[model samples]
Target: MCLIFRIILTAWLISSSSLSMALSIDSLRGVEKRKPNVIIIMSDDQGWGDLSMNGNPNLQTPHIDRIAKNGARFSHFYVSPVCSPTRAELLTGRYHPRAGVYSTSEGGERINLDETTMADVFKEAGYATAAFGKWHNGMQYPYHPNARGFDEFYGFCSGHWGNYFNSLLEHNGQIVQGNGFIIDDLTDKALEFIDNNQNDPFFLYLPYNTPHSPMQVPDKEWASFKDKSLIKLADARTGEEDVVFTRAALALCENIDWNVGRIQNQLKKLKLDRETIVIYLSDNGPNSSRWNGGMKGKKGSTDEGGVKSPFVIQWPGTISSGLEIDQVSGAVDLLPTLADLSGINYSIPKALDGISLKPLLVESNQKWPDRMLFSHWNGKVSVRKGRYVLDDNSKLFDLTTDPEQRVDITSQKPELTKALSMAVVDWKAEVLKDIAIDNRPFPVGHPDYKYTQLPARDAVAHGTIKRSNKYPNSSYFTNWTKNGDYISWNVDVLSEGDYAVAVYYVCPADEIGSTMQLSFEADKLDFKIAKANASGMINQQYDRVERMESYEKDFKPLKAGVIHLKKGAGELILRTTALSKTNALDFRMMMLTRESP
Candidate 1:
C-alpha cells in the first residue's frame, strides 16, 4: 500500500512542473506580440461638433463615432489655433514655433530634419511608417516627408489644396495628378500602404483636407442634404445670398467618415484588429461652417472654437470600450504617447512640453501631471493648465466651469492672472530663443506685398521694394493714390500658370469704385473690390479690400516674365487707381496665386 501511494504522488508532481513550464513559454510569446500598429487619422479644420456623436444634428459621422465607442473619447483635447502649428506639435511633441512652424505662411521654416519625430521613433522601433495626406510641413527637397522619417509619402505640401476633384499631389518627391475626390485619393493611398505593410508593425498618418475653404463635395453626397430644412434655416440666419449650408462641406465630412470605416475594416480583414491602435483627431478647430461643438470662436482666433478639437482612440482588446476621458490634452502629447505605446526609446529635444499618455490609456485611474499646454497663432498666445486658461489680454477662465470662456475672472483673481501671464511670456521667450534663423538667402527674394505708410492713404509713395533675385525686378507698390492713378509693377514669373493678381488694400468707404484698378500689362483683367468689413476693423465706415483678378494671359516658358525690364528692373507705374475720395487707400499687399502650368 505504501509503494502504490508513493507512485501516485510522483506522477502528480511531474505533471504540475510540465504545466508550469508551458505557461511561462506562452507568457513570453504574448510579450513578443504586444507591440501595436498605430494609425493617426486627422481631419483639416473639422470642428468638435461636426461628428454625429458630438451632437451635430446636421452631419453624420458614424465611422468616427465608432472610434469613440470602441475605445476612448477625449472630451478636452486642445490644439494650436491653426493648422500648420498644430501639425508641428503633433509631429515633434513640442510647441509649434519650437519646431520651426509659427504660421501657415512659414512654409520656408523647415522642421529641423535632425529633430526626433513620432514617425522616426516608430520607424526606429521596427515599424514601417507612412504619412498619407496634407503634409503642410515644408515642400523643399530636404524637408519633404521622405526626407523626414516616412517610408512612403502621398499628399499636398501646401496648407490647402484648391480643387478636391482633381488636385496636384506630391508622391514622395514627385508631384502627381490625382483623380476623383481628394479625400478618396488620400484614403486609397492609405489603404494601399496598409495592405502593403500589414505583415509588419506600421504607423499610418492620414491627414484629410476637408470642410475647409472652397467648400465643395461630390454630387452624390450633396444629394443627401437636399431635403434637409436646416440648410435653408442656417442660410436665412446668416443672411447668406448664396448656399449657406454647403453640401460639399457636409459630403466632405461624410467622405472622411467613410474613409475611417475603410481603415478600420482593413485592420479587421488583415486580422490585425487586436494588435492595431487607431487615433482620430482634427488638426485644429473648424472654420466658419456647420457646428463648432457649441464652443466659442472659430478658426484663426485664440478662442475655444479655434483650439479645441475632437480626439478619439481605439485599440481592440487593449483599451476599454465606450470610455470617456475629460482630461486636457493636446497635439504635443501625441509623440510621447505613441512612443510609449510602441516601446520606442529616445530623448526629445530641449524643452519638449509634452507628457506621455500611456499610463492614462493603460490605467484608468492614473492621474496626469499638473502641466501647462500652450498654443499660438498670429502672435496671439494662450496657455492652459488644468481648468484654467490665460489669454494674451490677461483674461482668465476656469475652464472646468466656463469651458465657453464667456466670463473673465481676471479682476476677481489678480494673482492667478499675473502668474499665468508671466508663464506665457516666459514660454514665448523660450520659443523665440529656439528659432534657428534660416541663413540661406531667399530663393525667390522677399515677397512683394504692398505696405502702406499710413492707415488710410492709398497711393504708392516712397519705399524701397525688395525681392529675391530668383524673380528679378518684382517690386511692391505701396501707398498708391486711390483716384485716377494707375500702378503697374513688374513680376518675373519663374513658371507659367493661371496666375491671379491679388492686392490687399483698405477701402474705408462703401461706394462702388471705392477701389477700382485694371491690370493692363499682363491681360485685360478686372475684379470687383470686396469690403473686408470684419467686426474688429479700425475704420468701421470703410471696408478693407484685398482684390484678386484672374490674368488669363499665356506667358513664356522657363523664363520669369516675357516683358523684360530695360535695366533688369521692370516698371510698376500706377494711374487712374480710383477710389472714393472719402475712402482713403490703406495698404497694398500683393501676391500671385499660381493655378496651373
Candidate 2:
C-alpha cells in the first residue's frame, strides 16, 4: 500500500514540473515571436522639405524626425503628383493607372473593384484593420473602405474637404460630425483603435488630411507661425509665392508633428512600441511651392519636387537604427514590403508592379536590381531609371549632376534616351491602355450598406444651377432660382428598397414653402420645405488663409419622406417646383437610409 501511494505521488510531481516548464517557454515566445502591429501614417500634400530633419529650418518636426532617427529613411522615395493616384498605388501593389485611377475627384478616383488592397491582406490574416482620415478611393460599398477590408473607417471620401474644423465626416457608412480639428479628430480615432486592438495584431492606416488647402490649423499651432518671419521662400521661378499660404502650410505641418508625437506616446503607454512598426510618408508633393530642397515643380508637375516624398519607417528590435536606403522606391512597394515584414502569406490577385523590399530593409549588403519607375498625370509621363529622368517633354536629365532637371541630356546620351522613350511608349500602351473616362454611375443602395450620402460634389448642375466653386470636390449647388433649375447624379441603385430620404440644404424663412421632387427613374418623392434653416458660413474663424473652395455652411437635414429605388442604373434628379423665393435653398447633399427591401 505504501509503494503504490509513492508511485502516484511521483507521477503527479512529474506532470506539475512539465506544465510549469511549458508555461515559461510560452511566456518567452509571447514576448519574442508574436506578430508585430503596423501603423502607417500618411500626410497629404506635405513636401519632402516640410520637416526639419529634411533641412527645412523654417519649422521643427522632432516627433516625425524621431521615426527616421530610430529606423530607416528612403533617400529617393516617389509618389504621384496628385492625391488619389498616389493613394491607389499605396493601397494596391500596382501602378495607379492599372487600378483605373486617372483623376482625383468624381468617378475617376475609384479603384477597380477587383484589385486587392493592403488592408484586405492583413484583415484576411486575422489582423484588425482600420483607416482614419481622407479616403479618396470611393464612397460606396464594395468600393468603400469597409468593403475594401478595413473593419473600421472614419473619414471623408473626397479629393479635398471644405471645412477642417469640426466638420461632417463618416464612420464606416454612417455620417457623423467630427469632434475637433480634422487632424486631431482622426488621431483620436486612431489612438482608440490602437488601444482596443493592443492584444491583437492590427494594421492602422492614419491618412492625415492636412497642409492641403483651405489651409486651416489650430490656434496654438498657428500662433507660432503667423507673426514669425520666414527665411525659407518658394522657388524664384514662379516669383508668385504667397508668404501667408506658406506660413499656414508650415503651421499645419507643425500640428501634424504634434499629433505624430501623440501616436508614439500612445504606443509607449500601451507597451507596444517595440512590437509595433510605424511608417510615415506623404501622398504627393507640396501643394504650393515653398523651399523643397531645390527640387523643381510643385504639386501638379512631374518634376522632382512634385513626386519626391519623404519615407520613414521604424520598427524597434527589428529594423536597424538611423539606416539610410538610397535605392529608389515608390508607393507601389508599400504593400509588398509590409506583407513581407509581417511574414504573412498573401497572394495578390494580379501580378504586382512592386517587389518586396524585405532584403533592403532587413539584410546587410543586399544586392538590388536597377528598376524604372514611371509617373503619369494628365497625359504626361515621366520615367526615372537609375540617376537619369526622362521628363514629360521627352527630355532626359542626368539627376546625379543636375538635381534641378534644368539641363536636357537626351542629345548627350541618345541611346539611353531613345531606349527610355520607347519604354514610356510601351508602358503607356500596356499600363494606360484602358485609361479612359470612368463613366460608371455613382452607386447607391448597396444591399449591405444602410446609409448612402450623395453630396453635391457628385451632382451635375443643370439649367441655372451652378457649383459654388470650380473645384467640385467640396462645392455646393447654388443659383437654383428658377423652377427648371435642377441637379442630377448618374446613379446605380443596387437594391429594390424604400429609403428614408433627406435633403441637406440651407433655406431662408422666405424660401420655406419651396416644393421639391427627388426622383430616381420612375420613382419620385415630392415634399414641401416646411422649416427654414439659415445656418451661417462656417470655417471663417478657422481659415488661416483665403481658400479656393467654397465656404461651407451648416446644411441642416430636412426629411423629404421616403423614396422607392429599383435595382438599376438611372439619373437621380432633384428638381424644384414651387420656388417661393429667389433661390430654392442652397443644395448640399442628399442622404438616403435603407428602410425596407
Candidate 3:
C-alpha cells in the first residue's frame, strides 16, 4: 500500500470500534462480485424542494427522482451553506473549517492535502477513480482532483464559471476545449470514463457547475420554461416577482434533470446499472429566489434552507426501493460512509465531525442518535439538533412545531438552548484551532500547475473591492481608489526553478506610463506597458466572458522578469509607484511560469 493509504488505514483502525460490523477489509476481499462501481452526481445549487419527489410543484426531476425512489433518501440531510465548504466536508469527512476551507474564494477554498479523501480510499483499493464537472475545492496542485486522488479529472476549478457553451476546461492536468453545453459535455465525458473502465471498479464524482449562475442555457432548454407560468406556488412562498430571473432559473434546473436522464440511460444501456452504487445530491441549497421546501433562509445563510439538501443512494440489491432515512447527517459523513460501503479500512485522522451512516442505510431499525450540526458563513452560526435550531442571534426554533422559524422559543427552552449553544461554541473552537489554514499558500512550482494565475478573487487587495462588473466572479482592481494600494497572491515555492511572470491588467491612454513592481522575497521585476485598447482583452486572450451580463472586460499585459532561489512559501505582490493618470491599472490575473530548475 502507498504510505498515505497506510497512514489513513492505520489511523482509522486505531480509532474505529464498530467498523468491523459495518464492513471489514477481510470481508470485502472475500466478496464474490467485483467491488461495485460508485458514481456520485452532485448538482451545484439544487435544494431539497427542487424536485417533484420532494414536493416542488414547479418542476419534476424524474431522472433525479428515480434515484430516490429506487434507493435510500436522506430526509434530514445537511451540508455547509456554500459550495467550497460542503465539498471540503464531503471529501475530507470533517468540518469545512477543520479541513482548511471556510469560504468560496481568496485561498479559503483549498482542501488540505493530509486529509484522505473518499476517492483516495477507493483508489488504494484498486478502483479507477475520476472527478468530472465542478471542482470547487482548489485550483492549484496538491488540492486539485488529480493530485487529491482521482486518476482522471475534467472540470473547472472556480466556485462558479462564466460560460456554459464550448468552454475551456482542464482534462487531467492539461487544458482542453469542450464541445457541447457544459452539463451535457460533462455527462458524456463521465459516460466515456465508465465505458473505458467498466472492467474495473470505478469511482466517479460528477459535481456539475450548472444551475448556479450566469443564467445561460441552450435556446431549446430556455424555450421550454420561459413561456410557461411555472412558479405561482414558488412565488407565493418566496414572494419573488422577477419573471425573467425565475424563468431562467427554472430552465437551468430542468436542463440539469435532462442531463441526469441521459446518464441514467447510459448506465442501463451499458448493463452496469445493477452492479453500481449511484448517489445523487447537491452541494448546497438554491442560489436563486425560489422555493426551498418551506425552509427559513436561502444559500449563504446559517438556516435550514441554506444547509438542507436532498441525498439519494441507489444500489440495485442492497438498498431497498423508496427507503427514507430520517437521521440527521452532514456532508462530512460522506467520506467515511463511502469508505465503509466500499469496505476500505481508511479514516480521517482529525476531527471527524461526520460519522459513517452505513448501519443506518443498511438497516431501517438502526437507531442513530441526533447530535449537534453546525452551519457557518462569515459571522453567522447555526446549530441543528433534531427539530430544534439555534443561531448566532440567540434565536431558537422548534422545527417540529415551527417549521418556518416564525417564532423564537429561547424563553421557553432556556436550558436546551444553552446546551446547544455551548456545543456550537465548542465545535467552532475545535474547527478553528488552526485558523492559519484558511490563508495558506497554494504551491507555485508544482508539475501539475507549472503556471499559477492569481486572479482578483484569490489575491488580497489592500483597498475596497471595486469590480467593473459587480458579479461575484468578475475580476478587477481599481488601484487608483486608494493610496499605496497593492494586490498579492499567497503562494509557496514548491521547488527551486527558473521562472517568468505575466501580469494581466488595463491602462487608459493617459495612464500609459504607470509602472508596476513584482516583488517576492528579495527579488523584484519592473514593467511599463502601452496605451493599447483594453476592450475585451480577457475574452480575446483567455476566452473569459462576463459572468452575468453583456459587459466584456479587457486587460493589458506586462512581462515581469523572474528569478530563482531557495524553496519556501510567501506572498507574490504587485505594487504601483507611478501613474500618469489617477488609476494605475485594473488587473485580471498575475501568472507565474517556471522555466527550469
Candidate 4:
C-alpha cells in the first residue's frame, strides 16, 4: 500500500482503539479554532537532578522549572541510555533498535528511511515543521531532516559538536556559520521560525546540545558556578565525580534554562502561550557521575539513573498546573501523546512501541494499564513494570524500596523474575534481529539534495594517520606523516553527476606543500596544499573545564575542482601523493556539491 493510504488506514484503526484521545478543539460561534502548536525543547546530558526543581542545590533552572510549576511533571520518566536512540524514539514513537539506530555516530545513527517520523505526521496533517539544533539522527539527504518531513532545519547533524560559539553549522542542506553560542543561535532561528508561522499550526523541535563535553558555556553562565560550593556530589559509592566537571555541567544546564526562558518569552510575546504546548526534557542521564538523585549508573548504563529523565510539559489553560503524575513514561510516548493531544491523526507505519499518555494527563480517574517499559543499550536490558525493575542481569528490584537496584529481590519474586527474564529474551530476539550487523554504506549525491557532506567522523583512517580523538563526532584526522596514509569512507552515490569537491583542512606554514588526491572507483581529482592555514585548537581557550573530545580548529575549505562519478558503491579515498614536511594536513571534512543536471 502507498504511504498515505497506509497512514490513513492506521489512523482509522487507531481512532477506534483505546489509545485515542478525544480531539481537543475550541469553538466560538460554531467556528473551529486552529490546531495547537507544539514546541518540544530537549537538552543534552542534563540529568534529572540538574534542575533546582528536582532538588539539586548546585545550580538554578527557573525556566525549566517553570514548565513543571505551570503544567505537569512526570516523576518517573525513561529514555534511552544515550542521545541518538532517544532521538529516534522521540521522532518515530518506536523503539530505537526497531528503527536501525544502534550507534550514536556515522551510518548507524541514521534512522531507516522507511520509518515515519512525528515531523512527517505533523507535516502531513498540515502543520509547519522545523527542527533547530543538534540533529543526531542523520546527516545526508533522505535521512537528513529536510527529507524527514521537516520543512526547515538549522544545526549540526553530528552526535556532538566540538565548538559551541560562532561555530560551523548547517541551514537546511547548506553549510553555514552560526551566529554566537550554538544554543542561543539555535533558539534565535526557532524564534524566527515561530514568527514566520505564528498564524499556522507548527511543530518546533529544539534539540539543544550542551553539558555534553568540550565543557564550553558562556562566560556569564560559567561565572555563576565557577567556584560555587556543591552540597551534593555523585553517590559516594561510585567515587568518580569530578568537581570541576560537575560545575561546568551545571553551568551549561543553567544556560539551557536561560534559552528555555527565551523560548517561553517568545511564545508569550506572540500571545501564543495558551495556544502552544511546550515540553522540556533531557535526552538521557548525566554525562558525568554528578549528583543525580542517588540513582545508579551514568550515560551509557541501562540503569535507572542513565535512562531516567525529567519530563515537564506546559499547556496553559489545558493541562492542569502543578500536576505531578507518578506514572512511568518514556521518550517513545512523545509522538503519540502530542499527536493525540493536538487532535492530529497519525499512525505508526510499523508496529507502535509507545502508547498515548492522554489518559493519564487528561482523564485523571481513567484506569491506566500497568505496562512494562524496557531500556536497552550496549547489550544491557532493564525492564520497569509498576515500581518493580528487572535489570540486565536478570536481577529484580522493587524501585519503591530499592531505587538504586542495590538489593536483588529475585529470591522473593521468583515467578515474576522468570517471566520478566523470558520477556527480555523474547524482546531482544524480536528487536535485534535485523541490527545484528550493519553492512550499509554512507550515501552521497542524492538527486534531491545539492550538497553531500562526509566529515572525519564518518571516515576511516589508514596507515599512520590517526583520528584526533577516540570520540569520532566532530573529530579530525591528524598525524598524516606518511605518503601512504589516507582517509576513506564507504559511500554509495545515488545519482551520477559531476560534483565540485572541497576539502576542509589545516596545514602549518612549514608543511604547506603537499599534493592530495581524492578518488572513487576510476574517477580522480587532485589538489595541492600550497597555502598554509595554521589554525590551532579552540576548546582549551573557551572550555571552563577540561575536555575529552578533540578540540576544534578553524580549518579553511580548499576547492579542489570537480570529478564525475557514476551511480554506484565504492570507497571514496583521500591520500597524499607528495608530502613536503613531517605532516600533510589536519583533515576535517569533505563537501561534494552536485552540479546542475
Candidate 5:
C-alpha cells in the first residue's frame, strides 16, 4: 500500500473511532484557509528550574518566561534522561526506544528510517517544513532531515557540536560556515525560513545546543555573572560546588533567551504570531548541579530533575493566556499534539505512546487524562502515575510529599509499587518490540554527503582490533596502531557508483610505507601512506566546546584510488594490510567521496 493511501484509510478509521476529533492529516490538503504554523524551540540541558519563571535567582530569562506568562505552561512536562532519545520521541510521537534511539550516539541513536516523522505528516498536508539547530538523531541519508520529510535542514548532523563561534554547519546538506554564537545563528536561520515561507503554513523545529557541555559561552555574557559572588540557588537551597560551570550554563541559557526574543519578535512583526503555535522546551535536565525545580537528580538519571523539562506553548486566540496545566506530559506528546492542531493524522508501524494534549491546550482548564508515563536510561526505568513514581529497583516515592525523591517508600506502598512494576514491564515490551539492533549504515552512493567520516568514538563506531587514543581530539577518531586492525562502518547505499577513498592517519618516518585497504561488498581499494607526517588539516571543523588553538598538526593524508561500487546495505571496512616499519599508523578516520556522474 502507498503511504498516502495507507494514511488516508488510517485517518478515516481513527477519525471514525473518535468523531469529536478534527480531520486526519491526509485530508488537510483541500482547506482554503491557512493552517497553523508551528515553531518548536527546544534548548539543550536547560532544566525545569533554569528560568526565573520557575524561580531560579542566579540569572534572568524574561523572554522565555513570557511564554508561561502569555500562554499555557505544562508544570510536570517530562522528556528522556538524555538529548538524542528525547529528540526522537518529540519527532515521532512514540517512546524513544520505539523510535529506534536508545541513547546518544549508541544503541541506535539514529532514528529508524521507516518510522514516520511529524515533518512527514505536516509536509504531506501542504505545510513547508524545516529543521534548524542540533539534529542529534542521525548523520546518514534516509535518517537525515532532508530525507525524513523536512524540506529544509540547517544544522550539524552529529550528536553535538564542539565549537559555537564561526563554526561549520550543514545547510541543506552542504557545509556552510555560521557566524556568531550557535543559538543566534539557529534563530536567524529560522527567521529566514519563516520569512521565505510566510505565505504558507510551516513547521519549524529549533533545537539549540546550549548549556549541555564543554561549558563555553560568549565572554560578554559570561562576564556579567562571572564577577557575582557565589551563592546558593533559591530553589536548590544549597551551595553549588562548581560556580564557574553553572555561571557559564546560565549565561548560555540567557543567550538562548535573547534569541527566543528575536524569534517571537519576528513572528509578531510578520503578523504570524497568532497563526503560529510557538513552543518552548528543553531536551533534558541541567548538566550542572543547580536549582532544577527542587528535584533530586541531574542529567542521565531517571529522576524528576533529570527528565522533567519545562514546556510552554502559545497558540494565540486558540489557547487561553496565563493558564497552568499540571498534567504529566512527555516529549512523546509533541508530535501528536502538533498533528491534532494541524488536523493531520497517519498510521505508523509503531503505535504512539503519547496522547494528544490538544484538548488541554485549546480548552481552558480541561479535564486532562491521567496516564502512566515511563522513562528508562542506563538500565533503570522510572514510571510515573498521578503523584507516585516507581524506579527500576522497586523503590517508590510519593511525588506529592517528596518531589525531590530523597526517600524511597516502597515498603510503605507495596500495592502501588507492584501495580506500577507490572505496568513498566508491559510498557517496555511494547516499545522495544520493533527495535532493530543492527547499526543503520552510512549511505555510500548518496549525493548529500560527499565525505563520510567513520569515527571510533561513536557507539556503533569501533575498531575490531586497535590501539587507543594517544594524542586526543575528543570530537574525532582516536584508535590506531594495531597491525591487523580493521574499522567497520555500517552504511546504506542509495545507488551504485564509484567513490574515491582517503585514509586519515599519523605516520612516522620509519613506518611511512604502510598500506591500508578499503573494502565494501566484494571490492577493495588500497591506499599507501605518502608522507612520514600527516597533512596539516582537521576534519572536525566544529568544536563541541570552546577551544583556543588548532589541533590539526598530527593528521596526515593517504589517497586511495577509486573503487566501482555496487549500491546496497553493506559494511565499509578499513583493514590493515601490511605494516611498513611499526604497527598500523595511528588511524583517525576514513573518508569516502561519492563519484559524480
Candidate 6:
C-alpha cells in the first residue's frame, strides 16, 4: 500500500475507534499486547547543572529530576556540541552532516526525507507519532515532521523562538498563534495527544525551545532568582547580561520543569505511567548563564561542557529505578535503542553509525562495544574513544581522568593522540564519501561547502557576541561591508532575465519595531528598495531582480541595476533606524534564483 494511503487508513481507524466506547486500560492490555508509548522531551540550551539532581541548589527541577530518580540516569552521556547537529543525530542515528543537517541555520541543509527517522520506525511498528516544540530540522513542506512520519506537528521551524510568551507556532502546515507561554502550550498539546492515544502505542517528541535567547519569563518565576546574591558575582564575572541571563533563564527552566510536571501528571491521571517510556535530555549544552554542571567549554565548542548533557529515562515497571550508568551514551544511539525495545522490525540503512543500547538496558551486564564517538559543529571536529578526545587544533585530553578537560595530554600521549587522530581522519573520509554518494551538500553557501579551499575557522577563537539590548540603528551600516554578506547562485546565467532575490538575516528582539531597507543599484536602472519586517529574530527580504529590456535587449552585456552589480564590483546598501546597542544581525544568505516566465 502507498504510504499516504496507509496514513489515511490509520487516521480512519483512529477516528472510528474514537467514536466507539474509549478503549479501557484492560482492553488495551488484551489487544495485541500494546507496546509501551515513548516520549522524548528535549530542552534547548539547558546546562548539565541546571537540574537539581545534578548539584544545582538554586534551580529546582523536581519534574526533570523525577525521571532520574525513577529510572536510569546516564552519568556520562554526550550529544553534539550544538542544537541542529544533535537533533539530526537523535533522529537519524548517524552524524548530523551525514543526515544532511550541518549548521543550525544555514539554508538548504535539512534532514533528508529519504532517510528513515525514529518517528518512521515507531509509526511502522503501529504507533501514532506526534512532534511538538522546536522542529528546526527543516521548514520546507517536504521536510516537515508531518511529511516525515509524524502524524501531528505543532511548533516553530527555527532554531530558537524569540519570545517565551505568545510565540508563533506551526500546526501541521498552517501557522498558528499560540496563547499563554510557548512551553505551556506545547505541553498542553502533548498531553492532549497522549491522553487521546492512551490506548495505543504512541511516540511523542517534545523538543522545547527554552533557555535559548531573549530570555523572557513570567514575573512570578523570575522572582525566585532575584535575591540570589551569591550567583550575581558568578554571573557578572562570566559577562552574562543580568536582565536577560538570570531572570529570563531561571524562568525558562522553571517553566520547562513545570510543563514536564504537567505531562507526568497527565500520564498518571490516564494510568499510562507504567506503560510509557519517558526520555528527558537537552538538545545541546548550556550557552552561558544558569548552570553547566562544572564542565569545560560552552555552547558551540566541542568541549565536555558543550556536548555532555543530562540523560534520564523512566518507565516504572520496565526500567530499573534510580540506576546510574557510567557508560558513555550519545543521542545517535536513541533510534536503535527504541526500535529494539519496542519490537520494531526494519533494517537500518548501512549509513547509520549508532548501536542499539537496548542490550545495556535489558541485560545490565552486557558489554557494550568499545567504539569512538565523533562530533562536528560548524567545521570543528572532535573524536572521543574511551578516555581520549582529539580535536582539529591538535588538542587531546584524557576525559576519564580529567572530566573538566583541563589537562592536555597531547604531548605526553603521542601514541594515543595519533590513534585518535587517525580514527577522526577515517571518520571524516567516510563522511565525505557519504556526502559524495548521497548527493547532499552541507548547506548552500555554508563555509564547509565541498571543493572550497578556504581554511576552516578555529572554534575556540570565535567569541560569543553579546546580546543586543537596544533597537537597530541605520548608522551601523558603516560597519557592515557588502563583501561580508553571503551570496550564492546555482550557476552563472548568460540570459538577462528577472530573478527572485532573497536575503535571510537576524536582528535583536528589541529591534522589532525598527525598519530596515535594502537598496540594490546597478548601471542605468532605477534602484529597487526592499523593506524588511521583523518576524522572529531575522528580517527576510524577498524581491524581484529585474532586468529592463529597454536598457539592454540582448544578453551580451548584463545591465547592472541598483541592486545588481558588475562582475568586478557591486554593492547593496542596508539602512535601519538609529538605536542603541540593542540590535545584532547575521546575514545568513542572499540567493538569486531565476524567476519563472
Q: Report the number of the highest-TM-score candidate.
A: 2
The segments of candidate 2 whose C-alpha lies over 4 angstroms from its true place after superposition are 1-32
Can you write out model 1's per-residue Cα lDDT over 118-202, one digit (the tens) per residue? 8877887788999988887765444667657788988866665545665545576544577777888888998898899888889
Tens-digit lDDT track for model 3 on 1-597? 699999999889866756675567658676566788899989888767778887766776898899988889988888888899999888888777777786676667888778878888889888999999888887777777888889988887777776577765768655567777889899999989999988888999999986777677678776677677755344354456455665666677788888888878888998988888899888887776676666777777778888888899998888888888866888888887877777777645666778888898787567777677788877578888888889778789988787677889999999998998888788778767675545467677785556665667677677653555554344466645444567777778787777787676666666667677777788677776555445443233222222353233545456766756347888877777565567777776666677886
Scanning candidate 2 in windows of ten residues, the lowest lDDT window is 232-241
* Residue 567, candidate 6: C-alpha displacement in angstroms: 30
Query: What tens digits encode model 4's per-residue C-alpha lDDT throughout 1-597?
Result: 699999998988887663333322223234566899999999998888899998998888899999999999998899999999999999998899999999998788989989999999999999999999999998878889999999999998999899998888989878788898889899999999999999999999999999788798788887888889999999875568899899999988988999899989999999999999999999999999889989888898888889999999989988999999988889999999999999987766597888899888877578877888999897889998888989888999899988877898999999999999998999999998887688878889999999899999999999999999999999999888888689999999999989999888999899999998899999998889998889988746669777888889997888888998989999999998898899999999989999956
Per-model lDDT: 0.65, 0.90, 0.75, 0.90, 0.76, 0.64
Candidates 2 and 6 compared: the better one by lDDT is 2
TM-scores for every predicted model: 0.71, 0.95, 0.83, 0.94, 0.83, 0.70
lDDT (10s digit) by residue, model 5, range 1-597? 699999999999987877634445435654455789999999998888888888788788999989887889987889988888899999998888877787576326788877888889899888899999888887666567888889899887776555577666767755567878778888889999999999889999998888776566777787787766644452453235466667778888889999999999999999998899999999988887786767877888788888989899988888888988877888989888888987776666768888899988876547776689988886678999888888767789988788888789988888988999998888778766665466555665576555554544441334445324321222444344555567676766676778776665666676677777778889888877767764444433333234432243344446678977787887877777776765556665555667765
In the predicted model 2, the residue pairs found to clash are none
* Residue 23 lDDT in candidate 1: 88
Q: Tell me the spans in candidate 5 whose CA falls farther than 4 Å from its real position.
A: 1-32, 234-240, 407-413, 432-436, 446-453, 456-474, 478-486, 492-494, 501-516, 527-561, 568-570, 575-593
Error of 2 at 318 (Å): 0.7
Clashing pairs for predicted structure model 4, backbone only: none
Between prediction 1 and prediction 2, the one with superior TM-score is 2
Cα deviation of 395, candidate 5, in Å: 3.1
| Tens digits of per-residue lDDT for model 2, 61-104 | 99999999899999888999999999999999899989989988
Runs of candidate 4 exceeding 4 Å displacement: 1-30
